[model samples]
Target: MTEFADNVRQAAVAMRALFPATPMQRNAHLSAKYDADIWLKREDLSPVRSYKLRGAFNAMSKRIAENPDQQLFVCASAGNHAQGVAFVCNRLDRKGVIFMPVTTPQQKIDKTKVFGGEHIEVRLVGDYFDDCLRAAQEFCAAEGGQFLPPFDDPDVIEGQATVTMEILDQMPRVPDRIILPVGGGGLSAGARAYLNALNADVHLNFVEPKGGASLTAALEAREPVTLNKVDTFVDGAAVARIGANTFSVLSDTAPQDVLLATEDGVCTTILEMLNIEGIVLEPAGALSIKVLDDLRDEIRGQTVVCVSSGGNFDFERLPEVKERAQRYLGLKKYFILRLPQRPGALKDFLGMLGPDDDIARFEYLKKSARNFGSVLIGIETKSASNFERLFGLMEEAGFVFNDITDDETLVNFVI
Candidate 1:
């Protein structure tokens, strides 16, 4: 084996002191649905509920080994990374400083604290991740502490490569293909490096959230380029820019090998996995699985492994996830309708509804109009065709309405 592969194996062995290898379970539902042998590398089942702990532990351990005098470690993260570093610090009894954006959820902050116990200190920094990162770096430099990057460092990449080693060891045979979810590219880069070093012939595919496709952009540009805006719905994988070190390893990747999953579509997969398989997946965790439908033809009858990256989903977001999934499936809609201001108008509108159509929201926006009033209405139904039938009846009855489900600005303000 190549030196890199040997190092990755060593890292994996060292990791046993902290936690056992994460499960590599074959998902029967996915296998039957795709007509292929499908397995999941359940990183979401890790101690911190993410693969992040591997990288953090490896990097910190190597750094301290290189210099035993080093005691202070610093990092900036609003989610998994912070928890990973905290867990490691607590386990090692090392001092750590964690910086998170001021807007981070209380649950995340609490989890980080719980993992670190007395070994780490949590600081609420700026309002944005970039700002928080800057603060962490400045503080680390000032205090002479070791700053742990989320995904860009060589040590961290080496640490994450352990996942690839564990997969090859646990699987009955080498998979025909491996699907990995990309964020800043740590996991993908590490896996790619390990496979290349081992001379493995596994076909690798990458999936990224459509709103924050940094890896796709980097591959296309031949370098890392920051996105102008990123949707935070898939918060775990929504990186504005791919890491520079990671891009070096992933630079030769073909654009065709990278797939994009819509945020709403990921929500659908999240709900499906939760309700059907009793599995909870955060938006980022569901990315690789969400792209399975797109690769059905290529992966049919072949063995495949998908990395479910994290399961730090807050139950508070379940309603929003359900709403987005329903909208993506065309089973829910919001519209503005102009109704005549007369007696029995409400009864007439209710009469136009199909048996499956239920009014989820109804509010008059302009009740003082003399002839007509503008009403904002949300409807839920069993099928998309129900909307068509309901709209047809509304039009025949002389109702004026505009579907606002796809209107981003209006929905943000009113919905």
Candidate 2:
């Protein structure tokens, strides 16, 4: 085994003192749907409801062992990493200072606090991650405390490799393929290294959010590249830049193995998992499963494993997830309609709706015109074809309407 893989095994052994290994269970629902032997490496079942705790524990354990006098640690994160560090700090009884963006969700902040207890103090430093990271780094330097990175260090990578070790132990045999979600690349890099060392005849596939394809960009360029802008819908995996150390390890992977998932597409997977399997997944957590559709033909009748990376979803985001899923599925649409000033016009329009069709929203965009006025409308229906029928009816009735459901600019400003 490579030195990295050996270190990962050691980390796995050490982790047993804290929590049991996450399950690698064959998923009957997914297997049936795709005609494949599908398994889920359930990292979402970890103590912090994510695989992040492994890296945090591994890194901190190594640091503390190296210098027994070291008691203070610091880190900057908006979500999972913060919770991981907090949990580790509380476990080790070490003092920690966690810096998080002010705009981070209250659910995450509360969870981190709960995990860390009195061992960690959270500082809401800035509105953005970069700003908060800077503050954390400066504090660490000034206070002579160890700085725990989210994914850039070798120890963190080794720690994440433990997940792969557990997967091999839990599975009946080597999987034909392993699907991993990439953020800063710690988990992917670590898992790939260990699996390679074990001589597992497995194909590795990496999934990244389309709006934040840092890993894809880096692999294409043969170096890390900073994205111009990132969509934070998959906040846990929405890294703007791939980590340098992680890119070095992942640099040789074939480009075809990397997949990009859209935010709305991920939402559909989340909803499906929740409604069908009772598996609640955060946006980033659904990356691998969401991309299974893209691999349907290739994975059929083959043993495949997808890392369900986290389950720390906030219920407040459920409405947004449902809306995005509906939009992607074509079950919902937004439109601007020119309504005639004549009485009963609204009633006539309502009458054209199918039995399953429902008006979710209606607003007047213009009211000054005497002959006609513009109305902003949102409608939902049981089937996507219902929109076609609705449009046809409006056309036959001489109604002028513009569908803006897919218009990004207008949707952002109006919807």
Of the candidates shown, which would achieve the greatest TM-score relative to the real structure?
Answer: 1
| lDDT at 98, model 2 | 98
**lDDT score, candidate 1:** 0.95
| Residue 45 shift from truth in candidate 1, angstroms | 0.6
How many backbone collisions does model 2 have? 0
Winning candidate number (lDDT): 1
TM-score of each: 0.99, 0.98
Question: For every model in order, what is the number of clashing pairs?
Answer: 0, 0
Q: How close is candidate 2 to the true structure, as a TM-score?
A: 0.98
Q: Report how far residue 44 has shifted in candidate 1, in Å.
A: 0.6
Model 2: runs farther than 4 Å from truth? none
RMSD of 1: 1.0
